[model samples]
Structure formats: structure tokens, C-alpha cells
Target: MIEDDAAVRRGVVDALEYAGYRTLEAGDGDEGLRMALGASYRLLLLDLVMPGRDGFSILAELKKKRAGQPVIILSARGEEHDRVRGLELGADDYVMKPFSVRELLARVEAVLRRTCERAAPEDKRMIPGGEVDFSEGRIAFEDGVEEALSEREGELLRYLLEAKGRVVSRDEILRHVWGLDPAKTETRTLDMHIMHLRSKLRDKAQDFLVTVRGKGWRVVS
Candidate 1:
């Protein structure tokens, strides 16, 4: 939990603990950013407006470094633009300030559900000329090339591989991979990530990650 307001932070942490969840609290943005990037927490609760390294900056850094980390933004700014910005910046959900404990917990549970479900499996997968080791976040090609997979890339590839050649919709990807509501979120983000993933996978012919026109994406393997 990261909030500049001590009272709000304390209440949220207490409520989360009461609900049988372990909690870590950061009273300012700097501490929040440090702990958020370094800690082993499953989820982050962030306040948007804070002194010294605002939540938006922290969120951007987190996305770049730990794209798979689940985050929910909490703020007094309830404007549509604010909410949209949060989601676009890779927040799994956004909760307005003065929120009830029940509502906050519900949102937390929903986000966590999506997160736990999409986590990469422990095993590695052998592809045509390469192997993807999920546990180590590394991909090795047959000709002695190896590359590290970012957390998001690893999870995306894992999901596509699990689809077993079936078309997985952009909406499904948004929900499963991003933990965001597909109906409310834009699909363009999904496409951009797909492009990045293909480049990383070295899909020269686009043979592996196939796009089904007017539908979704599929893994040819």
C-alpha cells in the first residue's frame, strides 16, 4: 500500500490485514517506488498524486521494469481521463479515494484472480528451433542465441502457447494478460505488445504468432 495520507494508508493496510492478507505500507512516493520495484509483493495499491516521484512516474517505471506486476491505482481524482490514463499506463484497476473497504477488497480480489490465473507455468517449452524456459525467463535458439524475456513477454508467450493453436481474442488477452476488463479497455495496447513480442521471438515470417483477421492471435505451434 502506498499513499501520502497516513490515515488513509493505515486504514487500508489494517483492512487488508483484517481480510487475511499480508500487507506492506509506504507512506510516500519515493519509498513506495523503491519497495514496489524491489519487493516480492503480488499486487500494489498506489495513490496517484503524491510528493516526490508521483504514482504515474512510479507506474511507468514499474511497467518498463516489471510489466507483469499487478497494480491498482487509488486516487481522489475520479475523472474519466484519470481512470483511463491509469488503465493505459498498465494499471489492472483503478479505485477512487473515499472508497469503502468492501469495494476496495472486491477490486483487489478480482485483479488478483486474473493475475494468479495467468502466471507462467513452472516448466519450459521446446519449440521448433528454440526453447523457452519460463522459470528462468530465457529463450534459446538452436544456433546458440539466447535472449531474456521480460515478465510481460514471458506471460504473453505462455498464454499463446497454452492456446494450442486456437485463436485467442484481443479481448481475452486484455483480460487474461493485463487483468483489465476487455470490454472497457482499448485493444491497441494488445497489438503493440504483440509486435514487440514478435520482434523478440524473431518471427521473421510471422510463422509463430499468427494474427487472425477480425478475430485474434494464435500460436502456430
Candidate 2:
């Protein structure tokens, strides 16, 4: 946990400890960032407004170095933009200030559960027109054509294939694959990536990757 308010931080830490959780805490942004980057923890509780290094900076660094890190933002900034910004910076959830202990604990539990449920990524998968070798970042089509995949494209395809049977919401893809906030309106990038993936896979008919209107994308067998 990283919080500047001493009383608030102590209260939260005490509550978490009482609930059978061991915690490491910091009262300022610089120390918090250091601990956050170095400490081994299942989840991170971060304060957006802090002295020295703010939560946004720390979040950006984590996104670059530890894309899979689970983080929840705690802030008194209740504006929609603040929440959206935190999420866009790769926070898993946002908890506003003056929040209840119960609510905070519930958010923590939910984030931890979601993180734990993510399966290990696969290095290769068989697609419709070819086999995607994620390790090599390339696709081998049946007609003997080969296409290279950018790192982002490879990760996106791998995520979709992992959740093959169901429609994955755009927000979920953004959070899990791009580390972007799902609530952000700029999803054109995601759409473009999907289009590129489809082209690379030779899925012009959309038989392999199907977009469910008002929902998300799904990979069909």
C-alpha cells in the first residue's frame, strides 16, 4: 500500500492485516515507487496523488516493465477523467476516497482473484489458415505464405485464442492485452490491430475471428 496520509494508511494497513493479509506500506510517492518496483507482492494498492513520484508515473513504469502487475488506484480525485486516466495507465481497478473498508477489501479480493485466474500464455496455436508461432512472432499459412506479427499483434492474437470459445469484451482486451483502460473511447487502435490480425491470418471471410456486435470478438473453431 502507498498513501501519503498517515492516518488513512495506518487504518487501511491495520484492516488488511486483520483480514489475514500481510502488507508493506509507504507514506510518500518516491519510496512507494521504489517498493512497488522492487517488492514482490500479489497486488498493489496505489494512491494517485502523491509527493515526488505520482501514481501515474509509477503505473506507466509498471506497464512498461511488468505489464501483468495487478494494481488498484486509491484516490480522492472522484472525477470521471481521473478514474479513466488511472485505468488507461494500466490500473486494474479504481477506488475513490472516503470509501468504506468493506468496499476496499472487496475490490482487493476481486482484483487478486482475477489476476490468479489468468492462465499462462501459450507460445503457439493453430489458426484457420495457418499456425501462429508466437515464440517466433510469425504465422505459417497453409498456402506456403508467411506473415510476421508485431509484438502487440502477437499478444492480441494469443489472448483471443486463449479465450477461444467466448466473445471477449473490448475493455477486457484493452486491459489484458494493451494495458489500456477499457473505458477509454479511443478504441480505434484496437480495431486496427484486429483488422491487421485478420488480414495476416487470411481471415477475410471473418470465419476465424468473429466480432459480435454490441459485445466483443470470438475465435470459432
Put down candidate 1 lDDT per residue, 114-136, tens digits, no spaces: 98886646568987689999989
Predictions in order: lDDT: 0.85, 0.87
Candidate 1 colliding pairs:
none
Q: Any runs in candidate 1 off by more than 4 Å, and if so which?
A: 119-126, 129-221
Candidate 1 residue 149 C-alpha distance from true site, Å: 18
Cα TM-score per model: 0.59, 0.57
Best by lDDT: 2
Model 2, 1-221: lDDT tens digits are: 99999999999999999999999999898999878866667899999888989999999987755556899999999899989999999999999889999999999999999989866677878887678999999999889999999999999888888875777777667767787655444759999999999999888999989999887888998
The 10-residue segment of model 1 with minimum total lDDT is 181-190
